[model samples]
Target chain A: MDPYPPSNELGATLGRIRGLVLTQETAQHAVDLLAQVAQETMPNASGAGVSLIHEAQRTSVGATDALVRTADDLQYDLGEGPCLTAWATRSPVMIEDTTTDQRFSRWSGAAAEAGVRSCFSVPLLRGRDSLGAMKVYSTVPGAFDEADRARLTSLSVAASALLGHVQTSETSTRISSELRESLRSRDLVGIAKGILMQREGLTEAEALAALTARARSTGIPFGQLTADIVNGHGASGRRGAP
Target chain B: MIGFPHAEEQRALINAAVVESGFTVGEVWLHYFSLSGEVDEYEVEAYLTGLMPLPSLECDLLALAVNELIDDLPPRRRAPFSDELIRSHAGSGDAE
Candidate 1:
C-alpha cells in the first residue's frame, strides 16, 4: 500500500531531505533530521533512530523518543536484531509483525511487549563498508509494506553518503587534535628536562629518570608530573640522595 | 586461568612483582620485545601460555613484560587493577 503522498509530494519530501543533508552544519543535525524525516514520512512510524556500528561498539543517536533508544540499546546489548542484520547483510529487513518473527526472537518478543509491533531496518552503506542502520518502529502490527521499505532504502542511500563524509571529517578532526596534544606533551616534558639540566647539571637520561621516579612515587601521571615541574610547584627540583 | 574475572587485577599483580624484582621498565620492554619482536596481544598471550604455572623466578619477568607493554598505551587506554583479588593474594605463591 502506497500510504505516502502522490509523486510530486514525495518528490518534495525527498528534496527536503536532500537539502537537510547538504545544509546541516553538523553531522549530528543531519542525523537528527534523518530520524525526524523517517518518522514523518514513513507510514505509521511511531519513532525512528540512527545506529552506528564501529569496532566492537554500537552507538545509536538521534532517537525520536525513549522507546526508540531502548529498542536500539537492546539490539546493541544482544548483538542481534533487524538493525544489526541489516548492517551485516547490507540490506533492509522488515518485521511486519514482531510477535511472529523468529529470527531475533528475544529482541522481537521484548519489542512487542514495549508496544512495538513492527520494525523496518535499512542499512546505511558506503561502498563495501556499512556505516550503520536506520530503524523505524510502529505500534500497529503489519504497519510497513513494500512501498514503505522502498522509500526508506532510497532515503538511506543519500544518508549513507552523508554519514560516510561526516565520519571521515570527524576522524580527521580527532587526528589533528591528538597530534596537537602529542606536540604539547613533548614540549612540556622538554621544558621540565631543561629545568632539571640547568639546576642539577644532570644528563638527559638522568633528568628523565629522576622525573619518572618521582612520578611513580607520587602516583601522578608522567605528563602531569612534568607539567607540575614546569610550573615550579609541589615536586622539589633538587636531586634526591642516591 | 582463562576464566579469571579481572584482567586488570592480574596485570597489576604482575606489574608489582616486576618492579619489586628490581628490573627497570626499559629492560622489561627490551626483553619482551626481543623475544616476540612485536607487541601483538596474541603473540604475548601465546608466550604467556608457554610459561604456564609461572615459576617464582620468572614471574617477575613475565610481569615486567606485561607492565612495559601496558605502560606504552595511551593514558586513557590504560586499565589498572580495581578488584580485591590483589589484597586476597598478597605475598602468596598463588599470585605468581
Candidate 2:
C-alpha cells in the first residue's frame, strides 16, 4: 500500500526517521537514510539504493539489500536503466513489467539472473535539477502500487531537500576558496605596487602603470612580477636571478 | 564499424524496444548469442528451426534481428562499452 502523509502507525515511523535525519550532518548519512526508508516500507523489496549524479555520471552512496546493491552496481556499470532515466529526467520511473520492458531487455536479463523483477526510481531533485535518485527493487511484478509511489515521492522530496543543502554547501566552499585567493592576491598586489613606488619614485597609479607595462613587454604575468619582487628582484624583475 | 559498444547501445534499438514491446513482438525473444567464442550462427539457426513450431514472416524477421544482435555482440560485456563511451567530438561521431 502507498504510505503517504503517514497514518498514525506510519507517522511514528516517519517521526523517528525525521528525528534521525536531523541528528546527521553528512550527505552520505542522508543517502543511507533514504535507502532505509525504501527498504523499510517495501518489505517484499529486495534492495534499496541512493545515488548522486552530476554531469551524467552516477555515484551510489548507500544500499540496503544485496539485491539493491547489485541493481545500483549494474546501473553504475551499464549506465542505462530505471535509475539512470529517473536521475536524468528528474522524474519517477516505475518498471512494473521488467521482463518485457525493452529497457530491461538489455539489463533485464542480467538483473533477472540476479533475482530482481521490478524496480521503482524517484529522482532526488533540487528544483528541476536532479542531484540524485532513490531506488527500490523487488522480486515480484507490480510490487510498487500507487500508495507506494506516493510514499516514495515524499521520501524522495525529503532526500532532495537534504541533498540540495549539501550541494549548496559545496558551492559555498568553492566560493569561499575563490574569495580567499582573491583577497591574498590583492594583498600581494599591494606590496608589489608599494615596491614599485619606492624604487621608481612614482605614485601608486604610476607604479601600477609601470608594472603593467613591464608585464606586457616581457609577456610575464603581473602576479609573477609581484612574486619576483617579493623574492628580491632581478634587473628587469624577471622570476629568475636575485 | 570501428567504435565502442556505446555506438550500438544508443542504436535505433532504444526506440525500437519502446515501440516493439506489448505490441507486434511477443514477450519471449530467443536470441542466438554467439559471443565470437563457442556458438555459431548456423548451429543456432538449426536449433531454432528444429525446436520452434511457429512459421511466419514475423517469426523470420524476429529470428534475423536476434541473430544480428548476437553477431553484433563483442567478446566482452556490452554494458561497459555502452557506459564508458562518450561523444568522441561532442557530436562528431553521430555526424560522421
lDDT for every model?
0.66, 0.59
How many clashing residue pairs appear in each of the predictions shown? 0, 3
The candidates' DockQ values read 0.02, 0.01
Can you give the lDDT of residue A228 in candidate 1?
A: 77
Question: How does the DockQ of candidate 1 come out?
Answer: 0.02
Give each model a TM-score.
Answer: 0.45, 0.46
Which residue ranges in model 2 land beyond 4 Å of their true spot?
A: A1-25, A170-242, B1-96
* Interface RMSD over true interface Cα atoms for each candidate: 14.9, 30.3
Candidate 2 residue lDDT tens string, A1-242:
22222233333332232222212246667677779877887676777888877666753378887777887778768768888899888779988867777865667777877878888999888876778888888888888888888888898888788878765443233233333443344456567778767776679756655665665567554455667776676353433332
Q: What are the per-residue Cα lDDT tens digits for candidate 2 across B9-54?
A: 3334432542444221211122211101112333333333343222
